[model samples]
Target: MRILVCGAGGQVGHEVVNRAPGFGLVALGRNRQQLDVSSPEQIAREIQEQRPGLIINAAAYTHVDNAETHAEQAYAVNRDGAANLAAAACQAGIPLLHLSTDYVFAGDARAAYRESDHTAPTGVYGASKLAGEQAIAARQPAHLILRTSWVYGVHGHNFVKTMLRLGRQRDALGVVSDQIGCPTQAGSIAGVLLELASRYARQGTLEWGLYHYSGQPSCSWYDFAGEIFRQAHELGLIERLPQLSPILTAQYPTPARRPAWSVLDCSRFEAAFGLAPRDWHADLGEVLVELSRLERRPLEAGVRRA
Candidate 1:
């Protein structure tokens, strides 16, 4: 099957493109520069030209704090771009698999969030993503919206990379402890999406709709940072482990309020897809090894060591 993967420059999109071939898929990847989702004309032209059997939209305006001030830009990409894709997919008689986030919730729930839970996004980024989800549901019948959290990978700017960079530079660091969420690996998400794609290829349908899929055993940022440092040290990706201090969210406030409880109940997804969530520790180890390999590569001009 031919799959069109948008936002190919992002972490999840990069993983999807690289791993698609192993699933017997022909993936056509388009970065923002190549196919900006915010531009309807560009999306229409690309969909027409590519004629892909499936479309996976990993494009998103993910800057939580920046979205507070840049609401228009955020909506342009997250909301309108998603609507455009859904409409085009509907017109083309194809299915769309779009990535979403746990931010759709208000973070006040004590229990893990289910797909049917009430949504009250507290910030612009979350609101925009929720709007995107709504748009897809309205426009496309054959759509799958996967809401994930704390996504990190080897190819993008994420919490894992930030922790690794800080661990190398500082002897000690503080991370927010009050906030809790699953640290999902980008490669694992890509693998799940490809598996679904393969199933759709064979069956020509899916029990599609909104679903929650995240890492198992939720932890705070502090805990995630500690794990990253431990794994990186074990892999020789980090020379030494940095001292980590757990602080409340108030100690580190941002323009956008992060979800205090981002844990998602992925039972519905597992039941529907028949795939279980992989242990995030194993995924973290794999990411650290990949980062190690990248660091060991001969550095070329304009390429800073990761």
Candidate 2:
């Protein structure tokens, strides 16, 4: 099947693009002057050029804090851009796999947020993403809107890479601990999208609904940071173990507010597709092992698996 992958350089986009050999893939990004999603005409043009059987949209204004200050840009890219893509996909008679966020929730729920959970965005980024979600839902009859949380991968800036970098520079670090969420790897999400898309191709049904996609187990930001650093420390890349002091959300002030509980329940996705969600720690270890190879170093003393 032919597929069009937008935001081809972001974490999720990069993973999708890298795994595109299974499908005929047309990848585009902002850096490529040929592709500008902000313009509806351009989006329509690209869709026509690719004429893909599926469109996977991974593009969005993702800087949570920055979105607070640049609400217009965020709205234009996340809301209007999504609308443009959905309209173009509808015109082309194709299903779209749109990646959304869990920030749409208000974060007060004691249980994991399900696909049917009520959305109450607490900040500009969340609000903008929610708008994009609604736009896709309004127009596409056979779209897969995957709402994921705490996504990280080998590509792009994410908590994992950031922690690794800081772990090397500073002797100790203060990571926020109160915020609990899942640490989903982008590669895993890409694989799931492929599986779902192939299944749809065979059955020819979009199913037309939202689903939560995340790692099986959940954790706090501090827990994620500690895991990342623990793997890094094991790699012998850093001289000393950085202090991972857990702090509250307020201690780490930001322009945008994040949901205290961003964990997404993946039971619906699993039941629909009959695929199992992966353990985040397992993927985390794999990523760190790859990092060690990239760094050309041996595993350090007392190094635990990622």
Candidate 3:
């Protein structure tokens, strides 16, 4: 079956497109020109052109700090854009699977969050994504929304990449330790999406309306960054292991507030698909290997600055 993938160049989107062929898929993105999802007309036109049996929307306005100022843009893309895409997919008589985040929770639970938990987002980004979930559910019936947390991949500007880049420049670094969440690999999430697609092509509708997915272990940002640097040091990629000083969320303030506990329970996904993601650190090694290989290529000779 032909599936259309939006947000095709993002961390998850990049992984999904590269591996989509495993599920007999045809992917499409905004191209370099940038497809604006706020416009329903553009979505309709694209749906007519691609004629995909399924639509996986990985596109989103993901700048957390920027969303505090540009909330209108975030809502337009995350909420309204999802609605537009779902409407288009429903018109085409197909299933729409969208990716969401764990930010929908208040993070006050002090433990892993289940699918049945209540949502009280503290930031514009989370609220906007939750709105997107609601919009899709309201607009269409054949939909599967997967909410994940602490997503990182080989390609995008993610937490792991930032730690490696900034960690080398500093003699020591400060990371927030109080907050906890899962460190999901983009490749694992991509694999999960493909598995869902296979089931959609087979049984057509899943039992759950929403599901949570990520790697096996969950930890704080400080631990996650520390591991990234540790692995980099092991690979001899860096000169030294920068001292990681753990701090609290209040110590490292940002415009957008993150949940103190953003961890998601993946029981629903595992039970439904019988799939479990790999360890976060194991996936980190793969990324480093890929980055190292890319560093040696002549085409990317000068691109490996960090």
Candidate 4:
């Protein structure tokens, strides 16, 4: 069966295309140039022509800080674009797997947020994503909203890549320690999506609702950066490590207000799919190896697995 993956050029989308074939499925990936979700006509035409067994909507305006200024652009892609896909999926009578974010919550909760938790987004990016969730829920009956956080992968730009880049350039770096969330890997999310796609492609139905899947042992961004450098050094990717300074969120201000506590409860997803939680730190090591290979730098002996 053919599975249509939007945002094929993105981190998760790229992983989905790479992993889909392993599930005995044909993956049809459409980047922005091939499919613009904001335009319903374009979406409808592509869906009609491709006639995919399932649709995975991974497209979104993910620039958290830039969304503060480009509210319209963010909404056009995240909210309206999502609605268009949901509507088209409804017409096609197929299941839609839409990826979401943890920013949908207000970020003030003391505990991890559940799927049933009330949403109160702090920034335009979160608000737009929340609107997209609402649109998909309202338009499609067969849909799965997979909300993930702090997603990083070898295929695209993310926090891990950012830390590696900055660490190489500077002797000391400061990262926010106040905000804490689960760091997820794009490959893990892709695996779940492909599993769900394979199931839906065969059965044509599922529970159809929102779910969460993130890496285990949530930590602050500061901790995450420290772990990245440690793994890089252990992998022999770097000779010298920079001093990582933990600072308050206010020390590094952005246009968007990130969630202070955005870790998600993944029990619902685990119960339904039976997919085990992934270790982000362990996955980070594998990612470093993949990235090193991509950069044409081979790792030294005695490299540690993530």
Best by TM-score: 1
lDDT per residue (tens digit) for residues 56-136 in model 1 = 999999999999999999999999999999999999999999999999999999999999999999999999999999999
**Model 4 lDDT tens row, 32-113:** 8899999999989998899998899899999999999999999999999999999999999888999999999999998888
Per-residue C-alpha lDDT of model 2 across residues 52-106, encoded as one tens digit per residue: 7888888888999999889999998889888888888898898989999989999
- Give the CA lDDT, 0 to 100, for residue 72 in model 2: 97
Clashes by residue pair, model 3: none
Q: State, as a TM-score between 0 and 1, how close model 3 is to the true structure.
A: 0.94
- lDDT score at residue 148, model 4, on the 0-100 scale: 93
Q: Of the pair 1 and 2, which is ahead by lDDT?
A: 1
Candidate 2: minimum summed lDDT over ten consecutive residues — where?
Answer: 23-32
- The per-prediction CA RMSD against the true structure, in angstroms, equals 1.9, 4.2, 1.9, 3.6
Regions of model 3 farther than 4 Å from truth: 31-34, 299-306
For each candidate, what is the lDDT? Answer: 0.94, 0.83, 0.85, 0.91
The digit string of per-residue lDDT tens for model 3 on 44-153 reads 88778877788888998899899999999999989999999888888888889899999999999966789899999999999999999999999888899999988887
In lDDT terms, how accurate is model 4? 0.91
lDDT of 3 at 306: 38
Ranking by lDDT: 1, 4, 3, 2
TM per model?
0.97, 0.92, 0.94, 0.96
